[model samples]
Target: MLVSALCAMLGVAPVWVSCLLFAVAGYALLWLFSPLTTIMIATLTAIAVLSFVKPHAGAGSAVIAFVALTANNMQNNLTASNIVGMIIICLCPLSLGFGLNLLLARRQAAAALKQRLDREHTARHLHDTISNDLAYMILRIDQASHRDPPFDQNQYQRQLADLRAIAATALDHTHQAIRQLEHTDGPSTHIVQSDGETDKQVEQQRKRLDDIIQSQRQRLKSLGFQGDDILGTFDQPLTDDVLDLLEGMLNELYANIAKHADPNVWYAVTVSFDQRHVIVSASDALKDAGIQLGLGSGLERYRAIIESVSGTFAVTDDSGIWSAEITFPLCRRL
Candidate 1:
């Protein structure tokens, strides 16, 4: 509008002619250069401003119209004030993105710090409590072995009593530390159905768990793994809570395999039930045996969960192979 008004005031060309020229030049430059058009327009504008070559209306109008169109194309204004405005516009998003990145980094740092502090606290507690008790117990046993008679019944009994007391104290201290650690993990996941839960709900939960197991078996087959996925029959339906826990554990197992196991190698996932317990076992060949697999926190959490239910969880790395087993006492069958 401003360029057209200026052209009209100078009696050089009609307003519509100036607009048409701007539209044609902008379209042609953009269609031909695409991304490079931004650089070309900038360069042309800079040269025209710096060289101070005042061409007549015919040429000047084309250049002015193009410069204005370039500014408009970039969603900016072609005016002296817009120089600072453009700088502010570009910096706004950059500053926002940088601020968000800093916030994320700060949160990550805080989480890492808290984890370190917890580990340090656990270390200190073990040293202060268990280490001293173990040392004293060892010394007492050593002294007992050096008795002159080697079988002074009364003295032996007294030493045994003292040892028992020390052992009990150490056990209590250990339990205390474990309880404190457990508290930090928020709520406990109990694999037992609530008293109010119905049998139909339990059946649905069991079906969901069976579906997950079937999917895992299909995935193993699709991945070209040789495995016997023996999803054994359950004589009695498992509780909903138990099913939920098993679902999570199953997902974690498959995810770990997907990440680290070699699909071409043989693998096995077996589920069985005895009178007292339900057993799950899995083994896979590692993709990279040279890389030692650490006992990651995920396995540790599951270990704790199994133990909390009076169950056992074990994992081992034998050469290039990894195996894990979890056995939990049959959750009060629905």
Candidate 2:
């Protein structure tokens, strides 16, 4: 825009190089900043530059020259023909600017479309992680029976603190993950979906899963569950989907405890790996004091998550003790 305006104004000025400088600066700003904002500002700036360029011809003169130039076919007036030529020469750069702006508008739309798609994809992955953890907390609360609510004022207070910490962690992770999603590989940078997630992306997700386990452990400990809780450490590499599924299952298990398990019962978590498959299991000493201790819908939901990746899910009530196990072959590469 600045270039076009300068070219329009300069016409044949002694300091014509100034127009080139303005054009360069305008293009630089447009490329470095948002195309939309730059185009708007640059368009106005171009008009301003044109106004100050001291052209012998303008909108008014161009109209007159157009009429005379049209008559030049029949009339023998050199001056009118020259005026028409000048008008065409003066309008060339402005026309170029108009076309350039239009091209930029198309590019802007493409970029926005790219961003929307990437945002949705990232949100699904990130939001699922946080939402799954949060759902577990909610389920725990819903499942707690008031028959003989455990803890006194201090216990209730501690439970409140633990809930707050868990929620805070989820909120923080949601914000950070989504923010990274939007900016880390901006809209202009296209990702080939067919290529799947890169090594770095897979590694980052694995780390996130580890953090989820750590935070969940802290939450369980705060709720009076500490002995032998599994510290999830895998000796083998796994695909992103498997890692996510594993983390989600553990989160669901915790939620089940929050919902069904007796507060006074002992809880333990176990995670193991064999030659071909990894096993993640949990058990609880039941208070069975007439409570149902059933899996209900939670079990089905967890089963679906595990089985989606061809994994197996099972829950057993051996005497007064309750145990659940999930196992799947690891996909080492993403």
Candidate 3:
């Protein structure tokens, strides 16, 4: 359009001829200069030449036409428009995108808040019903054992049967609450699910851990790493939370190895469980010194996870080898 306008103003060859020439010259100039440079050079050259020629519409029309063309051609150029015009033209889509992102963030926050409230309600339910029942049973037992009376054996047996009935009812109610909580969407849902079918849950946990370990080992093998893994049998029960985190921890560890380990060297992953704690460790030779390594956010995140559960995380870099160890407790404290 600019080419046609220029040709019309100058009474040059045909419009098609001018456009073809401009396109060819533009395609060549772009090979040598950036788009902005080419635009500036072309505009200045045209204006300089037009200054020598007779003025067309007082020369301002040609200058305005050039400015319009330049502005339309460059999306991010400061010369696109006046402030208000720029805001209306360019910032509308950006503002819409930001508004959408804010809405999504708010929705996520609302969901998280709901989950937290649900957990609190479940905790309160347990304390209100289960705790009171247990306390009452304990008091009755104490009174039965230490009361100054002609102890009635039949009455005592009746009280014991009542206490047992109370305990059973409380246990049933506790299981129902746990089931409801397990259905809620959150990180801790799996932990709640752990309470049902102990043998099945334990088997699933073991399979998950073994799968993660074997996956990492296979990945290392594919990377030409000769690695060893000692997936020792657990001596004690691992808390549901600890078992859940192990999956993430192992993935992060293997990811770190994939990113930084020397493919030609040996890596090792060892799992050892004692009565009190479970130990997991991985070690690998570092890649060449020339390869840059980032500050391991993965390790830092897992460190926080371990420490939150009263577990410990340790890392050591020595003699071109990197190693990390995690020691987590077997029991989950109330």
Evaluated with TM-score, which candidate comes out highest? 2
Stretches of candidate 3 off by over 4 Å are 1-200, 235-237, 289-295
Full candidate order by TM-score, most accurate first = 2, 3, 1
Number of clashes found in candidate 2: 1
**Candidate 3 minimal-lDDT segment of 10 residues:** 49-58
User: What lDDT is obtained when candidate 1 is compared to the true structure?
Assistant: 0.64
Model 3 TM-score relative to the real fold? 0.41
lDDT of 3 by residue, 11-87 (tens): 65677777667766665657576876666455544543443343342255344644575567577555535544634
The CA-based lDDT of model 3 is what?
0.64
lDDT of each: 0.64, 0.62, 0.64
Q: Which stretches of candidate 1 lie over 4 Å from their true place?
A: 1-206, 220-224, 332-334
Clashing residue pairs, candidate 3?
A: none
lDDT of 2 by residue, 117-142 (tens): 56644554454457656875675465
For all predictions, the C-alpha RMSD in Å is 24.5, 13.3, 25.5
Between candidates 1 and 2, which one is better according to lDDT?
1
